[model samples]
Target chain A: MNIFNYELKINLKSSLYYLLGMIALTSLYLTFFPSFSKDTSAFINLLEGFPPEFQNAFGIDLKNILSIMGFYAFILFYILLISSIQGMNLGVSILSKEERDKTADFLMTKPVTRSKILISKLGASITIVLITNLLFYLVSYMSINLIIEDTFSFKVFTLLHLSVFLVEMIFLSIGFFIGVFLKKVKSTISISLAVVFSFFAIGAFAVNASDDKMRYLTPFKYFDTNYILKNGTYELSYLVVGIVLIILCLVGSYFIYVNKDIDSV
Target chain B: MASNIIEMKNLTKYYGKARGIIDITFNIKEGEIFGFIGPNGAGKSTTIRTLLNLIHPTSGESTIFGLDTTKYPAKIAEEVGYIPSEIFYYDNMKVKELLKYSASFYKKDSKKRMAELVDIMELDVNRKIRDLSLGNKKKVSIIQGLMHEPRLVILDEPTSGLDPLMQQRFFDLIMEENKKGTTVLFSSHILNEVQKISTRVGIVKEGKLIKLEDMNTLREKTYKRVLIESSTPIDDNYFNIKGTKDFKTVDDKLSFLYSGDINLLTNKLSTLKVHDLLIEDPDLEDIFMHYYVREE
Candidate 1:
């Protein structure tokens, strides 16, 4: 309990910052929707000028761009990118900071198992992500109503938010695994940016028409906002794959961290 | 006759073929201040870390307080306080908070002891750890380690950052703790620091325990640095005796470390046409240098 509390306390301030950033970014984007809807046709006509492949790669769906949920999903693509970077940064830095700061000797010498330490840190990261997401959901949901008069389906709007949470979890677990497997992480932000951006880039640029299997390679494509907004539910196949990846990364991280030797600084 | 508090039987660790500690076996008895002496990278930290289960042993086994070290590290850690050579804490935290966090790990209430240690070390608990100087950080490490009041304390080169006055106080504190039945494992390359408090000493070289001796017996062996300036060149066998080694004649001056009887050495020195003679008790440095050189 002390370990969990200590971990949570230390990580609390940054989490609040992420929450504020999410609320501010989404609220600011939502305010522009009223004027943008007045010029919807002009915007759609300009988007249609680009080839279909370019639209598909960039997740620009013309059919739903005018609707509030559709526009929300469109904005979600950018939000997801930022959320993942936050998740990955939190994951890697939380566990690796002990070794990076050369405080492993102090913590590892305490009367607690390594599993306890890992779990406490994991709990802290999950709590931070959950709190950020919950507050984000409330503020953004209100903004959609406050900024635009269009009646958005509460269910589809919800499915979109749930998808973001799942994708963030997958990234967080992968970050934790990398943090444990690598002996040292020199710069958490650079590594997070490099990894998150590569996956984001892959999702943006690499859409092979013949083989749709490429979607499995990048977490960004796991939840198609178009599919969620239309079908009112997550695609079962990709959802299962995301959950499996999370479990595997977390389990592997646990086993590796438990047995790893903490050498002197 | 004290029972062994820590027993290592042929413990070994290899970091993927780079030697860490090799077949090192020794025992530290209860209520003993056992000094682990070695130069840097000579496996002192490796041996201590293995015992603490910071690194798993590649082979062999060790028991602390009659429990297997690897199998029961958390349990062993409950009654152990370790002051690492380098002190690192959460830089953002104030000294008081970090100390509280460290104390919360053990089942025992340590608030009283924590305050006592802070007072003795003259540490200001209000200061943030990042703002502290290197020596002040050392003080924090000491206070945190001892506040829990563990049965055993393991320190690896613990006094490097401390000034002489603080070092004396630290030793006094350890001695005070020792009087109350705490066993201490003090590892340092500095011989004088170890000589100040250790009841027994273990000399480690490369990856093995070279020698383990009682402090008094080790000192009583009386290794003297005997240097004689002879008027004429001395024969190699002229001072041949049971405990004379590194016998070298450099430019008509015979020098060797003699551990034999003082009277025998004096009689031999009187027979020689010595221009000057000097026999002094060898410092711990010379004694260790002799051991290290002899091993090579």
Candidate 2:
């Protein structure tokens, strides 16, 4: 509990920066939607002018482009991108920071087991991610409500927000696995960005491929915003896969960390 | 009866193909300060780290307080305090915060003891860890390791960054802890430092513990550095005595290492026109070299 509290205190400021960045970007993007709807046809024609591959890759869905929720789905692409980076950055840095900062000897020599340390750090990171997603949901929902007089389905709106959390969880788990898997990672941000963007690039390719098998390769494809907007629910199969991956990564990390030989700095 | 506080039985560790320590075995009795002495890369840190359970052994086992170290490290750690050679803490935390966090690991309330150590070490608790110098950080390490008042204390090259005055104070602190039945396992390549505090010493070289003996016994068996200033030019063969090696002469001065009978050297010196004679105990490095050369 002391370690948990300490972790929370140490991470609080950085987590706030991520939240603020998300809020500012999401709110700024939502404000542009009111004007974007006024010129909806022009925007649609302009989107249509691009190659079909480019449109599909960028998630430019003309059918839902005019509506507020549809506009949010378009904006969800960027939101999820930023959210995943934040989650990945948090997951990668938390566990490895003790070693990278050369404080492992101090912490490891204490009476607590390595598993307890991992749990505290993981718990603190999840709490930060949870807080970020909750604030992002409120800010996005409020901004959308203020801009559009036409009512949107509250259920669909919630489903969209929930997918962001789900996607962030996947990235966070993968980031954690990477952190534990490597002997050392000098720069957590660079590693996080590279990993998150690689998966995102895979998602872009999966968009064009639209292959059922390829969707499993990328977390971005796991929560299809279009599918969520239509069915008002997450795909059960992908949700199960996401949960399984998270469990596997976390469990593997615990085993590796507990059994690891903490070499001197 | 004093029990073995620590026992390593045929313990071995290999980092892939590189050797850490091999077939190492020793025991430290309760309330004794056992010095671990070795030059750089002599596996002193490896053996200490294995005992602390920071690194697992490749084969065999080690136990502290009669409990297997690998299986019950956290349990063992409750009564053990370890200070590594290089000290590092969370840079963002103040000294007091880090000390409090360390204290939380123990079931015992260490607030009073923590305050006492802070005052003894003359540490400013309000300062951030990053703002501290190397020696100050080491002072924090010392306090944190001792604040818990653990039954077993392990220190590795603990005096490196300290000034002579602080080192003396630190030794006094350890001696105080030892008086309370704390068993200390002190490791260092600095021979004289260990000689000052240790009751017994273990010498390691090239991944093996080569010698373990009582401190007095080791001192008895080691050589003395002898320097003689003569009134006459000394003959090269004049002092060709047994157990004398590395003999050298420059003008009217002569110096050599002597390990044999003190009476025989004194008799030979009396016959010569000796102006002045000085004999001193050789440093640990010389004694260590003697052991290595003897082994080879």
**TM-score, structure 1 vs. true:** 0.92
- A66-172 per-residue lDDT for model 2 (tens digits): 88888888888888898899889888888888888888888888998888999999999898888888887887788778867779999988998888898898888
| Candidate 1 colliding pairs | none
Q: What is the TM-score of chain B alone in each candidate?
A: 0.83, 0.89
CA RMSD of all predictions: 3.1, 2.4
Q: Write the per-residue lDDT of candidate 1 for residues B1-296, one digit (tens) a residue.
A: 99988999999999998998888899999999999997788899999899888899999999999999998899999999999898999999999999999998999999999999999999999999999999999999998889988999999999989999999999999999999999999999887688889999998878988899888977666578889998866889988987888787788888899888878887877777889988876665777778556655
Fnat values, one per model, are 0.82, 0.76
- Give candidate 1's error at residue A249 in angstroms: 0.4
lDDT of 1: 0.88
| Model 1: per-residue Cα lDDT over A4-32, one tens digit each | 88878888788788778888888888887
| Residue B230 lDDT, candidate 1, scale 0-100 | 84
TM agreement with the true structure for every prediction: 0.92, 0.94
- Winning model by TM-score: 2
> What residue pairs clash in candidate 2, if any at all?
none
How far out, in Å, is residue A163 in model 2?
1.1
For model 2, the docking class works out as: medium
